[model samples]
Target: MGRRSSNKQQGGGGSEVAPVRLHIDPERPAPRKLEPAITALRRGHVIVYPTDTGYAFGCAISSPRGIAMLRRLKNMGERDPKPLTMLVGSLADIGRYGHMGNAAFRIVRRLLPGPYTMVVRATSEVPRGMKNKRQEVGVRVPDHPVCALLGELLGEPLLTASVTHFEDEQFELQEPEEILRRHARELSVVVDVGPLWPDPSTVLRFLDDEMEVLREGKGPVPD
Candidate 1:
């Protein structure tokens, strides 16, 4: 594991504006070596890391600044009002932030630790901004191990959103090198697990007894 932090002050205000880059094995990222990334999240910094689908932006769920920065990076409008997704380490972690009934839980249990984003009713613990008017939230448990360890160490779900190449809506970016070049000033840390294949997690919405497919991406919708 390699940790590189940029501490150059921005403008005359003496605010440091450099992003840290960490290259770790996607299979099993050592917890001790990931302390720097944890520290960045603790300080409300945005991180770019690989997932089962592709590279995505992440930050502490409790950080308003981090959330606002992510929205800005993605060019989300001031009143865009779209709910962001939550990334957790395991199936058990989902209940902490969202409400999953028996049907929903059983359905989620079959597909998680793979490429899928399931929408469930949000609990009060989830930040309001990350929930829609109906208080439903999108959650994911990526197949990648680094993010699982990250969520475990951080002790909470992370705010997650996909990253694109230079405002290109047609593609999702997977190259860490390109992310470093394009988003260095905007991010606090970039986790490099090499180039992942580009794809987006399939999105599903579960409202009470009803289940609906919101977006058809990488994962197959459960029949």
Candidate 2:
């Protein structure tokens, strides 16, 4: 068990926004205890939680409103928005949402649950707006207990984006207090697993017949 704190905006003309921060013990890694965060996400609220790369903000992939909240938090306007990544629970879930060829599947199955993001063609089940103009989406299965458990609790993939305040910065915010101080107003929940070492996941793209390395970060790319 851990402590919880929240912040809410008052006397506002807009929708009521209150972001709660909850702590999770890394050693325990309890999935059943994350019900509140799951409930918030089910209601189309975005959350900031720890991942293998660092802290990231995510929401239910099916919620357009949640996507909008995520976009607003990241300052991604509809006119030209950065493509959001999906955090899936397993490789099977990835297949359900993305069309993966045998070659792509082989590589993905071997390297997932690590620090990597794979870009693949999206399936019809994927929301239209969530994909790139090429009909592809970036997916990740982070190697962290909290996120893995959170994904299981939600029973679906989460639309994810790395947490970064400055564009030049390559890593996400690592401290829970700092994450709350900057983004708690816009977020719905922050699942803190203490402080994290800052880094970014390696991004790999599997297009038609080629495997291209998009960005080299914490994970090593296979030749």
Candidate 3:
């Protein structure tokens, strides 16, 4: 049986939802083991899952409730212009949400499925709330099986944000047990694979077929 916790929502009108921790083999996650998480996402609930860079908060891209919860969890204000990153199953998925010009496409094609976040112009499919003031969204194709599988099962991009310590922004939460303890009320599921050391993905922004390094981290910059 899954562990349970109870808490009250801020402002005292509702109860907090307890998150279920699901342990699965990181390398070979069985579909049966992933069903619960998929169900939670489908129901507009947020989840915590491992990615190639680190652990991240994820929900169905179309879930407004889930997106609101994510923004609240991240302490993003209504006017905050930062865009949330979406985890996609493949390069083809990226094209559906982001507009990549020929020059940018050629470069991005070689660096994906790794630790990198690419910011591109958003397509009509992306929700307006998910895009930055510049009309752009961040997208990632992580080189992690769980991420790929989740995207495939969800049948849409998983809107994601890095799971970092609120007090210490530099500190990332890696262990599922620890993550559940901290965010049990805000999440519906915690996908456990084991502990992964903190290393954030490199962020690159593309504008009119030009690439610019916004923040360099795990992924190396190309010449």
Candidate 4:
């Protein structure tokens, strides 16, 4: 569980507070131990947690302040072409946020819960700030248990930003303590599951029943 300390850093303007660190088993995350992180998310606070690809910065989907902080952290502008990705619990949640055709759905059903990011038309449910100029959004269903449980407990998709080293984009922050050392000022909580190497998710775009590979990474390209 997270410490009882305050976790209210907002849009890079608030006083710096020590981020609460919660260590949970990556293979079998206990819900009881996750309550504090859940509470922080409900309050629209940003968190750092492990994902199938790597660790990512996360916040509730409906948080404007959280979104602002995320964009600032990523050095992204208001009209940046790159859309933010969301972590969801299941395909059903993906459908709720994105418009996936039958063909796209079939492909996603097969490859998801792995390391893949599907770009699709966003539904009205998605916040405008999270979409790209094409009105598309990136969505993921990570195979990691901690990510799965976080989505399940939050009851909605979490807006995510990849945690990359500012000095070297190629380097990944593998340890929770290192993540805290660098980002404690901006985050509310850090969900630790030991070290994990970076392996970016494969990004694919689906439009008009056609599929296009945007960026190939960890996930294998489908035939």
What would the per-residue lDDT of candidate 1 be over residues 143-213, giving only the tens digit for each residue?
88888899889987899888853235567436787877777777777888888767878888887757899
User: What is the per-residue lDDT of model 4 for residues 109-152, given as tens digits with 9 covering 90 to 100?
Assistant: 99978999999999999999999999999999899999989988
For model 3, give the 10-residue run with minimal summed lDDT: 7-16
Model 1 regions more than 4 Å off:
1-14, 165-169
Q: Judged by lDDT relative to the true structure, which candidate is superior, 3 or 4?
A: 4
Stronger candidate by lDDT (2 vs 3):
3
- Candidate 4's clash total is 0
Q: Rate the local accuracy (lDDT) of all candidates.
A: 0.79, 0.77, 0.83, 0.85
Tell me each candidate's TM-score: 0.89, 0.88, 0.91, 0.91
Best by lDDT: 4
Candidate no. 2 TM-score: 0.88
Looking at model 3, residue 119 earns an lDDT score of 93
Residue 22, candidate 2: alpha-carbon lDDT: 72
| Cα lDDT of model 3 by residue, 1-49, tens digit | 2444454332101245566778878899888789988988998888899
Q: At residue 201, what lDDT does model 2 achieve?
A: 82
- Residue pairs in collision within model 2: none
For every candidate structure, what is the RMSD over all alpha carbons to the true structure, in angstroms? Answer: 2.9, 2.7, 2.9, 2.8
When sorted by TM-score, best at the front, the candidate numbers are 4, 3, 1, 2
Best by TM-score: 4
Check candidate 3 and list the clashing pairs.
Answer: none
lDDT of 3 at 33: 82
Total colliding residue pairs, candidate 3: 0
